[model samples]
Target: MKEELLATFSNHFEKPLIDEIMEEGRLMEVPAGETIMDIGQYIRSMPLLLSGAIKVLREDEEGDELLLYYLEQGETCSVTMACCMGQTKSEIRAIAETDSRLVMVPVQKMEEWMAKYKGWRNYVFESYQNRLNELLQTVDSIAFKNLDQRLVDYLKKKVEVTNDNQIRNTHQEIAYDLHTSRVVVSRLLKKLEKMKKLELHRNYIQIVNL
Candidate 1:
């Protein structure tokens, strides 16, 4: 983990900043399918993902979750920054999309770094910009696209993140992410299969194309 931290930090951060981070941060490994943060949870430590991916979800008033985006290697959580900066709570939930490793930095260090290091400030702003762009794209997709188109987009997104055309999510899981019913997801999957775009199985969908 020490070597991994050095490799990751060397890309953008200065040596002194990296050393302080290594000294102050704690390394944590999260298994696949684990929820790292939930709605309304207070932020204490900011996580810097070193490996694997995180699936970010926005929960509605009724507790239904809508997929927002994926945060992969070297991507920090923008929501974490918002909560840390404002002394607020998390509005979205973050789940490990794969077996993951993260370096958890105390909220104090996060704030100090932002003020003390130009690199840290730049990273924070870049993270916010990237997340905002992703959210805007998500809104556009939901507003202007049909359900089938959205489903295809979701599947393609998963493929892009995982680099695998085979998506190991059940229809119910897909529905939960897409904010639709399982029956609807199943019907659409069948339609997609018939169109020769994918093959549906018990738990996974294999993309034949796109």
Candidate 2:
């Protein structure tokens, strides 16, 4: 765990802060498609990604969910941190995008470390700014971009984060993340295939021109 922490966060955090994390943080491994946190759940700890990716999601009052952003190695979710600091229930959901490793830091230590460590403070502020920008981008995409374009962009982002040309998510899963319908996703995917942008299969979609 110490080695993983050092490898993932050594550059971003001071040695003393790293030591504190080592002493207080609990290392965890999560499998792909696992829901680690969900709406209305009280957040007891903040997760620091050690390896792999996590997808942060937001749900509507109707219970429809949309992808907010992806958290990669060495990054943490700002929304989760906010809930932890505020001692409130989680408004967003966190799921493992791949087989993931993370360090769960107690909520109490989060505020304490902010006051004691410059690196921690910077990290927290930067995370908030980054997440805010991503949220704005999501809003823009929904408001301005056509569904076809948004679907392409979403596929590209998945490819980027996973570093895989073939997307393994089913049409229904894609619909859930995009907050659309499975029928719509299937239609758009077929259109993309006809346009030579991608190839649809029984389960996964393969990138061709995308």
Candidate 3:
């Protein structure tokens, strides 16, 4: 699993460094719907996702979860922020969306690896920069793009991977990704379905246009 996690960073670093990092890491399994990291709990290690997905969510005073971001396979958690700031607690909860395999490494071990391996350090730095760039892009899109535009753009990107006009997704899942309410996504999807642009099944939305 650690080998698979390191493969995601393969393009950013040398094979030797990736091997070393994996060698020093340990694997952990997280069950679906479980908290990988709870809000207000200290994160002593970083978890590199090897399989499955996780969601970063914020809880309100009333205990309602607001989706912040989603972590796919090959992505690492934001535990680095807590480690760097020496924070004793986190404000966000990392919840596993599916049964997940993670490559965990202690902060001290990560620091030691960075000191000993230049490639490893560079890879981590690049990962942070890439994540920051993604967040900035999301902010820009939300600020300037309307919901329809955003949804269309998202479908286009998904179509590239799916290689078909059809997509499998739910209104709730789309809302989570779009950082909007389910009612909003449902309303917009209804319009799209009426237009024959897609079909809404029991729990999945299928796009009909390429």
Q: Pick the candidate with the highest TM-score.
A: 2
Q: Is candidate 2 or candidate 3 better by lDDT?
A: 2
Query: lDDT winner among the candidates?
Result: 2
TM-score of candidate 3 on Cα atoms, chains taken together: 0.74
Cα lDDT, model 3, residue 77:
55
Write down the lDDT of every candidate, Cα atoms only.
0.90, 0.93, 0.71
lDDT tens digits, residue span 1-210, model 1: 767877876776877898898899999899989999988899899899999989999989898889999998888999888898788989989999888999988999988998898888888899999999999999998999999999999999898877788899888899999999999999998999999999987767899986
Question: Sorted by lDDT, highest first, which candidate order results?
Answer: 2, 1, 3
Minimum summed lDDT over a 10-residue window in model 3 is located at 78-87
Q: Residue pairs in steric clash, candidate 2?
A: none
Model 3 sits at a Cα RMSD from the real structure of 3.7
* Tens-digit lDDT track of model 2 for 1-210: 889888888878999999999999998999999998999999999999999899999999898999999999899999999999999999999999889999999999999999999989999999999999999999999999999999999999999888889999999889999999999999999999999999888878999888
Clashes of each: 0, 0, 0
Provide TM-scores for the models: 0.96, 0.97, 0.74
TM-score of 2: 0.97
Candidate 2's clash total is: 0
Candidate 1 residue runs with Cα over 4 Å from true position? none
